[model samples]
Target: MSKPVYLGKLTLFWCSSCKVPVLDGKCACGQKTEKMTITPPGDIRPAFPYDVNRINEVSRKQFGADMIRPDEIVLYNKAPYEDRMEEIICGGVILGTIRFETEKTEWVLMPRIEGARRICNTKTFTPEKMKSGELKNLIVLNDDAVPYVAEGTSVLVPGIYDVSDNISAEDEVIIITKKGEVVAAGRAKMSSEEMRNEPRGKAAKLRWKGTPADETSPEYRDDAESGFFSAPRTWDDVIAANRNILDTFERRSIDFIRNTAGNMDKRVTCSYSGGKDSLVTLCLTNKALDDFDILFSDTGLEFDETLENVRKVAEIYGKPFRTTSAGNAFWEGWEINGPPSVDNRWCNKMCKLTPITALIEDNYAENGCLTFIGQRKYESLARAKSERVWRSQAVPNQIGAAPIQDWTALHVWLYIFREKLPYNPLYEKGFDRIGCWLCPAASLADFMNLRITHPAYMAGLDEKLRPYAEDKGNPEEWIRYGFWRFGKLPPFMQHIAEAKGIITGNPAADAPAEKTGE
Candidate 1:
């Protein structure tokens, strides 16, 4: 059984003219925009150089060349998957998904029709080139099979007119027409030689189909090259495109902050998390307030970059900075809890909330403080429905307010660029969200990333968790595949783990708890 997917606000619009996402229906270039309906909980972000290079390398593995060009602006929207799956968007269309597979331990690109069309250009690239080993993974389908494959039918051995040698059973392949228009992507059921010699059977199983949702394929009917959707777009262009809207939003947020804080006669402070959202909140707080304090939670797991950003932000603003200590609380709890899972996050409260709440109480003893924190609605379902100003049951006496509640990820990034704020540098390094280096909520993709950037840090964490994992399941597999994240193992996960004998005993029980933040 599979879980139902929750789609958040479908208000994301893209401007083809400027090749950038816009907050409004109209673009600064005076072009009408198209709606980009992406995966749920749409906290989309820009694909920085690190991320783009990763995508290009993955594309090169499956397809012969790079599908993305330097001039284009790409967006990444995280989808609900066991490890990691990011829907990649460019030129106002969701070109495909880039997923991290645990068994393979590599990034794979599952291109949409638009994405396939981008690479399978008949002009510069041809079937002759593939046979000569200059290019690879090409499968030319007979004309009769083209309509069937386009209609979502598997390609049979008899349907294959030509095939490339690089393909083996279960390898990702591009199914194209005799004239070279890509209609579907598939996993080879047999090797290229088997497809050529075998009498009959499925040559490839259709994985993803195209074209009831995108443009009509008349242009590619004659085997022409794709436009590649390449257009130069800098962050400056995005800022300029949304200039009017950014100014409007800044003014509104500042006003809301001033009015909301004025109504409350309590001690004031802005929550600084050293992440992008909090950085933007701090900037807004400075504009709205005459005098306010800055509060930071020094959760022992924080990264060196985060700690540095927190200090720099305080020093730059010349505000009274206060840090609270959790003081070995996480380690003490983890000793009993083992490893916290997505379903059971007891570490959040023990490591962060207790210390933060205690700090708030000690400072504002009489009346609780009104803390302006960075909370965006697009980040999750609970936040989308949450009030702009509210009280946290966990934290006594502190009235919480979100100044950037309605802002999207793009809005935050563009604002950061406009203000020239000294934000954390990790965003450019391919990290979507920054906080604890070993956050339990993080996926295997996030963990694997540490191998290159923080091998020592990951080694230290693996040493601690390996002992705990050996007691519950296959030690190495458990940690490697991120099975420790599932207290109540998801059905799909259980099937995979059980087949491999990774989970030899009962799965861990889920002890539910609310997640404050990363």
Candidate 2:
């Protein structure tokens, strides 16, 4: 069979020495000028000519009529569609018309329909540019330096020495500079620890370009000694830093609670997870407001320590703490629907949303209420894009306010410091989130930490997932995928890792565990 011939525009160079197309790997122009080739979609000239309407119908069925943008065009061969191209076509193609969203539009030469001829392609076009932003509140590294980063600066690898919290991909974030100037901001391509540890690749893809520092927005004004990066330390320093952090946190937290109470309706509560964020949020919320409720959604997959911690937090706060489970119904739901994917997360619906919705419906009983959340904009891009206060369309008549929406991870820790709030033991042991024992959002390092610190929890995860893996007829893929994801199998199950040891050490699979405890 003949090799598949790629039909496209061929460059012909008229060399004074050898007048011909630039063929045979040599240019006719004794000067040896290089030639380039370009191809457009859809074979204009084909041996097997099919109806144009059929192609249009298929394209429309697969992609919406607007699948291809007006600014773009499509390319195709005789073969079936390429998967990558299919995505691009659906997301980025148009017809022969090219539109320009930016200035500096220019004209270029396009190949004529036949005979290697060229014509002036009177088209104006622009490349796609995406923008994002983050807000940076001044955070003190020590007694010395106060740093400021703005809402829209690229977070490079070298800029960050330590992370403030357990942020995930696609979460909104606020960026502050080491010198106290808020830099540019955008969605994080990687997490906080991922930015600190990963040596290569673009750490956070900058959405909005930052304004340069000037007299109005000074650059690097903070004293070097005061900055936290000035003195990096091991686990032992956490206790010493507590005093400084707590002092600052207590005052701000009190203010935050008061402001939240004043701004929202009577019904407010904390989204308690027994982790550092929610714990701090609960303590601070209670301090500021009177008779606020705490809602704890038991995903039915929480670590034993997390459950205990919930009890402890509730007892200490002296507030009514409620528990709602995913129940057998959720388990049965998963059985019918199969596992949830990254985009399609029904678990959040079954476990997190349903319980909260039920509670609001039963307790509020048609009364208008407001809920306070511990969500910080720095947690993710989706969160960052959100407003500080918004009405929940899902839950009618309830307003949601994230009092600490603009705060950074470091700020949360500062609250823990000043108030001397009781935190989940897992934070000391290096677990960032203390929700479900096997949360899909955890990083690889988080999973491994679970293995070393909480082996029994790992065992539970393995047992729970085993049946699902078997039902899928690809037990190995299922086991290996979730194991390396967040919930680590116990050390005893190291053989499981060894048996199908093919997948490990991947950034997608694991990261270096953050050291929080001795």
Candidate 3:
């Protein structure tokens, strides 16, 4: 976690002509692209309809409008944070970022002008010009305040701001000049009523400073001024935009598989995870070689949909299908090592590696199969720096190769959509990354969604977890806030737990519960 993960020399680009993101400088439409300044490790992903809706829902709550239109194609780059945060991209410019605050279980929008302008209008009420109630977070400052705020200074009360009726202390506000230019976006230190009545404190703590002159894109600036963003589009439009790039990338991946298969001294096999990445890898492997097996490791906790997808993929490819299961190992490990946490994933050794290692040793002996995994660099720092072809020191018998190591999530998804592959329905249902149902690495938002959609599974997990929290605090609060995921609570979590009287200190190290519940 200490080491920074960079996606290497590769940088992400936004294609204005195609209305989508492209991996290279030149877009499929033969138009030059704008380089996106995304935060590292820049493993950006296309925001799905579900993700889009959720973001818009958050924006609507704060700004009284949706920052991203459902019809617009948008991409999100993950940012460093305690919980979930993503930098939203649209119209070849940064719209803003939307993040989930773990303590509040709330989604907050940290807008740039591209996003703030969509929901805010800085007009005063005239017969021809009127301020909409929907533009409720606006703070208009006098002429004296504009230049100072433009310099990234916080809005001071002495500037004599005229604030919107809905402005409340701690509410996110869009600071604009009397002339209607957006100056900054910040959190309110004083409510609208307080700002009007009082005279000597910071009015708003500015988080993002904005000036039209600071932006390089004249077209984007024009669009912002005229409100020209968010035209109607579909997923098909996205695919069409990246069609040329996809075909070229596909050919390269196919060639990689062929070369890796041809050179391997042992048998070549494709590992299937029933995820979009693996699906593309399997398709490439099928095209690359005539003889190979599709291997799957069922870790007892896998969803039935995932299991079905595995079977369907193998059947479609007309390849040999082989699977091994660690049927009761996870449950047994739970009794010994406790539930798997982000820091300590004892579950991986038991459920995946042990079964796979055993299968590789028994079937292929010493010179193990050359397994092609659907590994992508953008997934993590380690994976980003990982070599395409290598052997894990832990499982030296097996040789692993990644054909799509450089692919972004968008690349994998577009490939899946173009090929009309039978992907897991869970993605459409809002599961972005497919894995075990109870993966601790997932945010609390994921589990809350599961509580409603998969009640039986959630209820089962809660039953096991509730008993452990009985002596700690309100069992319901502990579960509701996702206190069970951490073996050692991070500082932010520790702060929340202490405030809630959930526990006096880190509970995991304090005492070990006999049996456990990620």
Candidate 4:
């Protein structure tokens, strides 16, 4: 499954005439306005459970330790559609974003400027921080070269004053004036030591420059204070505020289920995965239909908690529970497929789709079955544009329907809570979504949480990947860093490996056979 990529927050520009949030400086009435930070009433959810430490680590590594408050709540607002973009909101304002890039890396997208000056940006700190030696990745400009380094201009080697000795080429850096004012945030063209010594060359390629504006304006002050932290304190609070919307959603979904079932000539069943989405679907399905079966594809790689939840939910609903097993299929196919990566997910086919197809064929081959799934548009682009009910070419004899296709993660969570349903314990244990214990699609943050919650599972994964790493001429660190999860190393990982002078070999060459727990 493709993960949601958080691009960043929507830039809020206030129209003075309109007195409301506008997408840009121009209002519908053609009135130009200034940027303002206004905390809008909305849901503030964790990007991931263990993301707090990761966010702090990024802040500390980029700026300095104790720069951002440890107690500050870090939340995310997802972008519309399946773009995989989320705006990182804090204190009721968009601070930055945790973006899942196409390269299989999550990037922090911070604002370039608060108003007229560059105060801070994600991965790049302010010039004051650089002068205080708080920011290690920095390029100090020469005294005579301040005028030339505008918002759009590049920093040249000839005008360089000082550079951090630890700075590497391609590192994100803050270019600052001698007086400690930030000029721009950019990528270093050359290493810090090399840039300082080189007579003539580009030092840093600017991404965003400091704009000329009135920093002392009241708009700027208001913008600074606006943040997402001022939103609802808890999920319950959020749900309570949107109770009417939830009611409408529940009514619509129940109606959809009834209408779809009324039109279908086959038996009704719900595809339950024991995850939040699926659990919601199961609940809605029960509300819509008097009698329906629950079809669960037990991939065998599922967490024990998930398996137990599935049984519990089925028993609670008094529904006929049927399960299909992909027993050891994922492990057996590992030798041929290597490891499942974000780009290559053969495991899903072997463990999920294949078993689901067989289960349908054996049970409902004559008339087929209409399966209500817990698919949401927020999950991916493909699902976003998907029809409310459709037949998949991949899975024959099965018609799929998603009642909560328009719902968001927040909505699903709220509904689950409102219904007083017993959700999977994995979510309480810091898992946002439940799936295979060692799913490669999971973020590094998720993996860290998994390590803390299920050390044995992680250790088992490490053991499995160890031989593959060794066979591929990669160190144990390859498995340790979760490099084995990707079929191809992302640019970020490639940079780290290259900096360490580690040459990674192809795992496809002389691949080892799958071990039978020997």
Q: Pick the candidate with the highest TM-score.
A: 1
Model 1 is weakest, by summed lDDT over 10 consecutive residues, at 508-517
Per-residue lDDT of candidate 2, residues 255-338 (tens digit):
867886776546766778777777767777777777888877787767778888888888888877766776665566555544
Off by over 4 Å in 1: 1-8, 207-227, 472-475, 504-518
Clashes of 4: 14
Better of 1 and 3 by TM-score: 1
lDDT of 1 at 380: 74
* Model 1 agreement with the true structure over 1-518: per-residue lDDT tens digits: 35635534555788867778887887878888877788777777788888989988888878777878887788888887877899998877888899988677788888877787777755545768778865578788887878888899998888889998868887778888766667788678899889989999998888787642222367544223234554667888888888877898899999999999999998889999999999999999999997999999988888888888898889999988878988787777777666667666777888888899889888887988999999998877788788999988889988899999988787898899999999898887778989887776787788889877888997887787687667754758676676777677777667768766775322333433333233
Model 4 reaches what TM-score against the true structure?
Answer: 0.69
Mark the 10 consecutive residues where model 4 has the least summed lDDT.
Answer: 114-123
State how far residue 134 of model 4 sits from its true place (Å): 4.3
Per-residue lDDT of 168-268 in model 3, one digit per residue for the tens?
89888888876555788889999888888886888899888876332226745555544546666676887877788888889999899899888878888
- Candidate 4 structure quality by residue, lDDT tens digits, 1-518: 44434322333443444343333455546667566453222223444444556555654565444223444434555553222345555443455444444333344433333211223332234455565767566677887776677647798898888776667776667666654456666678899778867889988887767642322467444433432123224444434445655788899999999999999899999999989899999999898889999999999799999989988988898888888999988888886667776656667778888899999999999999999999987666587678889997878999999998877666677688789988998876756668888887676656766778889998888887788777757676676566666556667667656755445633442243242111
After best superposition, candidate 1 residue 431: deviation in angstroms?
Answer: 1.4
Clashes of each: 0, 38, 0, 14
Cα shift from native, residue 346, model 3 (Å): 2.3
Point out where model 3 deviates above 4 Å. Answer: 1-4, 122-133, 178-181, 212-226, 473-475, 504-518
- List the candidates ranked by TM-score, beginning with the highest: 1, 3, 4, 2
How does each model score on TM-score? 0.90, 0.46, 0.89, 0.69
Candidate achieving the largest lDDT: 1
lDDT of 1: 0.80
